[model samples]
Structures are given as C-alpha cells and as structure tokens.
Target: MQQPAVPELAHTQTRPIHWVLTATAVAAVVALSTVARPGSATAAQSATGTRTTTAAVAPGTTGVQFPLDCGPVKALVVKKAGADLDGDGRPETVAVVHCDAPMGTPPDGVYVLTRSADGRRPRVVATLVRPEDRLTVTDFAVRARTVSATLLGYSSDAVPSCCPDLRTPAAWQWNGSAFIRSTGSAHSV
Candidate 1:
C-alpha cells in the first residue's frame, strides 16, 4: 500500500477524554442556551400604548330592556356580536332582538348596547334598525367598529310576513357622533 500524504495526528485517535470533552462542550452549550431566553409576552396595543392584562368583557344582552315594546310576550335576542364599536377599549354588544311571538315572522330591532356609567347594567346606546321598519336581520356581525347585516323585508304591504320579498345589505359605522348607515340597493328575493 502507498504511504498516506499526511501523518495521523494524536487527536485523530478516539479516547475516553475526547468523549468526555465532547459531552462537556455539548452540556455547556445547552446550559448557556437555557440561560438566554426571550422576555415574557404582554397583551398591549402599540398604537395606544395601553397594557390590557385582562380581556375587556363586552356588554351582555340579559336583563337589558330594549326600546321595543313586546307587550305580554318578552323580547328575545336573536343574535349578538361584540366589538369596540366606538374606539373605546371596552367592547359593546350589537344585539338583534324581536318579540317572542308564538307564530309568524317578527321584525328585528338591531340595538347597540354599552355598559352603564355605574357598570351595573347594559343600556341601549343606538338603534340601528327599529322594529317599526318591519325588517329581519340576518348575516349579522360587528367588526372594526362597524356593524353589518343583511336586512330582509317586504317590498310592499301585500307581501306576506312569512316570506320577505326584499333583501338589502347594510352596514353602520361610528362617525364620532352617531352610527352612519350605508345601505346597498335592495333586490327582490
């Protein structure tokens, strides 16, 4: 066999000390990695520099007396969505309520609810859709300080209550003073 170009060095031989040194180097790297870590996460908004340790609870629909008068039957909340509709840190609830009628389709009243000054109860802040409008609320949602819904209504008085003939997509956004409604053109359903 031809002689190799380089001679074997002493370090090339495997020994117990070499194994111990390798293990020590690996252990040191692991220990140092454990000591160096990222800081604890925080729930804070960078824009407002507000630190929210606990989540803000939205206003609840229970016990809230909506502006609608349901007579003997109680007013029922059909759907609800919560968000910061007024740019406040606290969340407000947008509720779709109607009379708990035994039969026939009842008109829905979309109301914005906020916590009272004493935080004792949720009060109606604005009425997006009044019951008198005779409209049913569907595909409802509250996002980015806006309330959106698809309103179902009758095109004329001849249309039966069981089936709505007109469908309109509507959205309400807070304009600092009031919630401005932007309604899409109605279409027959």
Candidate 2:
C-alpha cells in the first residue's frame, strides 16, 4: 500500500495518560452535575414574607351529611369533581348524590362540598339539584371554576319514573355570594 499523505496525529495514538485524562474529564462532569441543582420553587408569597408551595387539598364527599333526607336509605355519591370554584386557593368538591334504593331510579341531588373553617371535614355549601326535582345528573364535570352537567328529567307527571323524556344542559358558577345557574333549552331525550 502507498504511504499516507499526513503523519499520524498525537490524539489518534492512544496512550495510558490519554485514558486517565478521558476518565478524569467524565468524572468531573458527573460530579459537577450532581453538586449543582436548582432550588424548589414556591407557588405564592404571602404578605408576611413567607413562601408557600403546598396546595390546599380538595374536599372529599365521604362523611359529608347532605341536606337530602333519606330516611331508610343512605346517601351515595354517584359522581364528583373538584376545583377551585370561588377563586379561593382551596378546592371544593361538587358531588352528585342520591338515595341508594334497592330498585328504580333515584333522583340525584347535586351539592357543593367544602372544607369547614377548621379544615377538619367537608360540609355542603350549596345545593345545585334537589331530589324533589326528580332529575338525574349525567355528564357532570367541573372545569375552570364552573360546574356543568346534563340533567335528565320527565317532561310531565304522566311520564314514567324509569324513563326521563327531557334533557337539559346546565352550568353553575360562583358569583361571589352565591352560585348562579344558567341552563340551555330543554329538549326531548
């Protein structure tokens, strides 16, 4: 074979010192990466100059005594969604509850649950749907501090209890003092 045009470079030739230097550089990079790290960030700062990163836990529906009076049957939470509804940092839970009956469809009652002043237990703050309304809740959700749901009900007294003929889309939002309800046109199911 013909001789190469350029001579071999020093780096191309591997020596014992080259291996030791390459290992040292890799070790230094790892050591520096582990030693230097960014600090944790705080979500909000208070007037007292204290930083808080902990978020308030959303209220749970369990053990909450709703305003509904279920004499023999216990109230069961069929659906629930949690969010910061009233612009408060703490989150509130909107629960769809109904009496656990052995047979037949039970009317659902929608209640907004929040933690008590002591943050010990959840309490019903608002009632969006009453069991007396004879409406069943469907597609229930809480998004962007607004509660939206499709309510199913009977068009008239003659309508069978098992079948709801009317379907209405409803939404509720906190207007400072109370929850304001807005509903869409009712249509036959």
Candidate 3:
C-alpha cells in the first residue's frame, strides 16, 4: 500500500536565518566600536592593572602604577616631550635615559622608552647609538603615527677617527590595524 504524501513546509513558516545573521553582525560592530574607542576609562582600566600608590604628583594629578620589570638596570631620566611630530597637541613621545652599558663595549646605547597614549609608563621603544661607533643612543623622537630613532657611531682606529655619519634612523607608521614600515627604510643596525 502507498504511504500518504508528506506535507511540505511553507517558506513563510521557516525561521528567518538572514535576519538572525544581520542582527549578529550589527551587534558585533557595536561591541567592537565600544571597546575600540580611545580614552575610554573602561579601556584604560582594563589595559592596566589595579592602582597601588596614591602619591599625588600635583594638585590635580592622578596616576596609576603598573608592573615594570627592567631587571637590575636603572633608568636615569624620564621626561615628557613633544611626541606629535605634526603639532596636533597629542603627546606621542616618551623620552627616557639609561646609563647601562651596551652589550658590545665602552660606548653604550641610550635606551629610549616609548609610552602609549595614556603615558602612564614607558617601554624601551628604541635605542640611540653614540657617535664613537660605541652604539649609544643620544636622541630619539616619537609621533602619533610613527616612531623615528637616530643612532650615532664613530671609529676609534687611526683612520682619521672617522665618525662615519651613521645616522641609522628607523621609522614605523600606523597602518590602520598595526604599525608597519611605511617606506623602504631599513629596521636594522
């Protein structure tokens, strides 16, 4: 005996998969924008851990303490300088000095700590080598979209004591997602 014909489901009765997908995409965009917004208090708090010290630097100054693991080496000076190379009023520079000797010899490179936007603390962004070919970092600069570092080196031989003019400058620019080499500049010594 032939079985009864099965009933076909109507398209209108089915769940709208496209609607669900569109809703999910919209939610994801909203969530990403909310988390990516700059200067968000929540974002800053999440990036850095809890605050430990309440020492006031100034009348209206507030600061946060984060873990800094630099081993035994000490940083000589930490100061604020113009980071925004374009003169946009946004601080993109983190200048630091270290007396630590370079791995090679007498002339050690000065370590420059580059800080993020918040400017709470800094990390070793680059090194400037001395003019003696001793590999010491003398000066450096950081901008919102790029980081430029210069290294000076000199020869100690009797060959006229040539400095060689080894600029050894390196730069990186923000490429929408991450910092990448904007030009054909070499990133090595």
- Among all windows of 10 consecutive residues in model 3, the one with the lowest summed lDDT is 57-66
Q: Model 3, 1-189: lDDT tens per residue?
A: 876597665665547897898899999999999889754231122336865333222111113221233356543343234343333333334343433433432333333234445655544444333223444344455655465555444433542322433445555554444445333332333
lDDT of 1 by residue, 24-74 (tens): 999999999999997643236666786666567787899998999899999
Of models 1 and 2, which has the larger lDDT? 2
Question: lDDT for every model?
Answer: 0.91, 0.92, 0.43
lDDT of 2: 0.92
* TM-score of every prediction relative to native: 0.72, 0.74, 0.31
lDDT of 2 by residue, 1-189 (tens): 988999877688789998999999999999999999976432477899986866667888878899888899999999998899999777899999999999999999999999898778999999999999999999999999999999999989999999999999999999999999999999999
For candidate 2, the TM-score is 0.74
Show how many residue pairs clash in every candidate, following the order shown. Answer: 0, 0, 14
Q: Between prediction 2 and prediction 3, which has the larger TM-score? A: 2
